[model samples]
Target: MKTMTRPRYRLAIAAVAAATALTACGGGSTGADGGLPSNVSFGGGASGAIYGVLATGMAEIVNTNLQGVNARAEATAGGLQNTRLVRDGELTFGLTDPRVVYPAVRASGEFADEPPAEDLRFVMNGYPSLYQVTALDPNIRSIGDLRGKRVCTAAGIQTAMLGELLTPYGLAVGDLSLSNLEWTECADRMKAGDIDVIGYAGGPGAAVLIQAFAGSPTAHIVGIDPDKATAMSAQFPWWKPSTLPAGTYDGQTAEVPTVEISGGTLVTRADTSEELVHQFLTALESHFDQFSKVHPLASYYSLPGTATNTMSDVLPTHPGAARFYRDKGIPGY
Candidate 1:
């Protein structure tokens, strides 16, 4: 929403083994081990999206590091969508963006008409990326050029942000031939010459965007005009300035200006036991090596900025996660 903080987190990882041991004290399904419950479903982003990949990687990390636990990442819509799933109990935990969390908690912005999911709780926020608007056509450059193009965006925050992305340039969501298809579908359509542009945000090496780069040498990132960036910050102040630096993705030699999006926040319903969440965090830290192995972009998950300042904060932090944070002396509880 409008008041959400620019998602920032700094995981306090000064001592890993001790932190892991302390957090892993009991919990999980095992009577003998501090492992998570079996077959837990983790809400990743929509299939083939960055969140999906990250969730899948996390599942593996949970599996490899925690015994008696069978955590699995399930493909779901995305941050905002996952928020609902977690609240409804269909998902045990989910990765979400602060932008979605703020609005959904208070039932404002796009959620102003929707009911609030009051049970959601924060785990941690880390890993961030910027709005990377891509187009294979050389004619597409500024956000205004997207006016008549078939731009792919899914439901939830994607559409909301797209609307905001267009406003500074005097374009609205209606100005574009918008496609609300899933991430993979959008990528497929782009390759089939059915779509003109797609905008997404994630760390430097998201798998889906990388595939787009490999599929077409013509793929190039579009940069927002300096004036537009300033204008966007003025209205949707939650968005902080960001840049997809040169060489972060293939076939690009110049930095493209953009706005930052929230990194992943592992969350669950308030009813989830404190012990379970605590063990989950413990496993997460203990398996950092294996987790990072899932993707180059996973490197962004290291403990860092983890709170919502851009968005309004009415949701309470999970007691388990909060306990761990306090124990570690991590900043920005």
Candidate 2:
């Protein structure tokens, strides 16, 4: 993986999304008259990705169901930043990617030089993600095509994934004319034909790719070689087998075989109120249909699916969430 720097795109969610749904039964416990006295906040990914979108939906759901307990979503640089916020108790909850969450808790990988976040707690694990290599040029079709081409990505994590994506093709940073432009800048340059590929690692139907498709009606989503999927996963343990079904993106007529990543997670601090976590999970499960409607990528966030995917020997589920899963008979951490 290349040692690329993360970009600065820190913009807080200016306005809280208003909750529209009515509360369902079996929520959190309250004190004297109602819920908690003050408001709580949720941290999400950079504004454009699925994590940020889900965070906004979570806040709206919380505010809608539990009246006095206002919840807000904070837009962040993504999981690495959000995990620190949640671990330090700066955020009541956060939407994060497992790549960062696992390391933050264990102080491994990117966080090797830092102390482990002993306070981190799992809330919900969700959605399979992929390394979306979007290109405006029809000539660019696979990782091999990126050779000697100008490829751009912003964050270190995204760059690491990009490096891993290239390994099977026997490519490296020296094999291409690489650039470290911010994500938005990459998009702009790609549109201007200054960059051949704009790469990112996230769930399907990423907003940037959607806008790219709009900008270049015939823009293609360059896929990894299906034959190399297993070798790639073996070489990079974080990657898993993935496939982008036909119609995942507009104008995409055929399934694009790819690799899945270990990410798309919701986490909280260990000390956060169990009742609050419980209620949040309850609201999430009850109103999941509405959340799924917020973004096409959200279709991956089903209870059973998330439960089955979340459990790992490394990450631990929160006690509050564990109880919810146990009672519901969902087999997971």
Strongest candidate by lDDT: 2
Cand. 2 TM to true fold: 0.79
> Per-residue alpha-carbon lDDT of model 1 for 1-333, expressed as tens digits?
111122122212322332343234311223345334665667776456668888898777767766766777776556766676677666778888767787777788757987787888777675666788889998897888987788887655677888888898898877788877767777888888988888776676555577677759899989987778888877876567778889978878988888876677777777676677777677777778877877666776665454342343566888877777767677665
Query: How would you encode candidate 2's per-residue C-alpha lDDT over 10-126 as one tens digit per residue?
Result: 332322221111111111233554335356777776576667787888889889887678777676666777677667666777677766766787898888988798877777767
Q: How high is each candidate's TM-score? A: 0.72, 0.79
lDDT, candidates in the order shown: 0.71, 0.72
Q: What are the runs in model 1 whose C-alpha is more than 4 Å off? A: 1-40, 45-49, 60-72, 109-114, 136-140, 150-157, 179-196, 205-219, 306-312
| Colliding residue pairs in candidate 2 | 98-263
User: In candidate 1, where is summed lDDT lowest over 10 consecutive residues?
Assistant: 2-11
Segments of candidate 2 deviating more than 4 angstroms:
1-39, 46-49, 136-141, 182-184, 214-218
Worst 10 residues of 2 by lDDT: 18-27
